[model samples]
Target: MEGGGGGGQELSTDNVKGIVLALLSSGFIGASFIIKKKGLRRAAVASGIRAGVGGYSYLLEPLWWVGMITMIVGEVANFVAYAFAPAVLVTPLGALSIIVSAGTFYPE
Candidate 1:
């Protein structure tokens, strides 16, 4: 398929790889947020202080740490994906992932 505005240049394999990476990154990042939120809730219950109210107790929660690590991995994937594809193609896929994650986690 000839890419628009690229003088009939075909999409490279790297571009496909980038799109896949972007999708993976989005999924992980979304899961991380949900995990972190769950951890924060647990921390709040354990410590009697809500994280939203400036409680740092979630910092001690293992689940929260796991979520942070997940987010980091997602970010790294996103960065690498960016290297393989144009931002125009990558960004939207990432956004879609976020939407999917949100809908999966919060069903209200």
Candidate 2:
């Protein structure tokens, strides 16, 4: 907790915590999607199946499962962030994940 010697609120400790948590949530979820996509691509190449074409081969992929678990953890952080801040703040921050995902893309 940070203290303001002057008698005015500079951002309470909860809000600061919420902001950090929200950012972490967005980053994790964004990176997770990219990872999941890569995993699916690898699985498809190995199994002669494409998830986009309704293939379930990703279910057998450990990388895909890792991405899934990462996504779940990110979602948990997002939910916890909501507990410390208003949705007005958290919802807009959620868009950072889209930015993160876009940055993570490659033309491969």
Candidate 3:
């Protein structure tokens, strides 16, 4: 598909880099979610209160903090990818990332 108002511009090297970055972002984000869940579970076990039940104990978990930082880095990577590539190319990669993450880590 041709991009709008660009005289049929094709994908460039930067677009390739963007795609790679987006994929890496997806991986990091997916892993971070898993890590954060583990931290939440640990916090709940230690405090005898689930985060869903208004527990703030997870905030003190170092693993949770690491996961949050991983997510932030992922987001930053995604943002940079967008800057280097078109939305049409980037959006599908994001969706694929979510699908892959779900398929890889989804509970039965």
Query: Model 2 off-target regions past 4 Å?
Result: 1-9
Model 2 over residues 1-108: C-alpha lDDT tens digits? Answer: 557567785667888888888999999899899889989988999989799898999999999999899899889999999999888878889899999999875656
* Runs in model 3 lying further than 4 Å from the true structure: 1-10, 105-108
**Least accurate 10 contiguous residues by lDDT in model 2:** 1-10
Candidate 1 per-residue lDDT, tens place, 1-108, comes to: 544575766679999999999999998998998888889888999999998888999999999999999999999999999999999989888886568566775431
Candidate 3 lDDT tens digits, 16-49: 9999989988888887888788889889989999
Evaluate model 3: give its lDDT: 0.84
Cα deviation in Å at residue 85, candidate 2?
1.1
Error of 2 at 91 (Å): 1.1
The number of residue pairs in model 3 that clash at the backbone is 0
- Report how far residue 33 has shifted in candidate 2, in Å: 0.6
| Model 2 residue 80 CA deviation in Å | 0.3
* Candidate 1 error regions (>4 Å): 1-10, 106-108
TM-score of each: 0.83, 0.88, 0.82
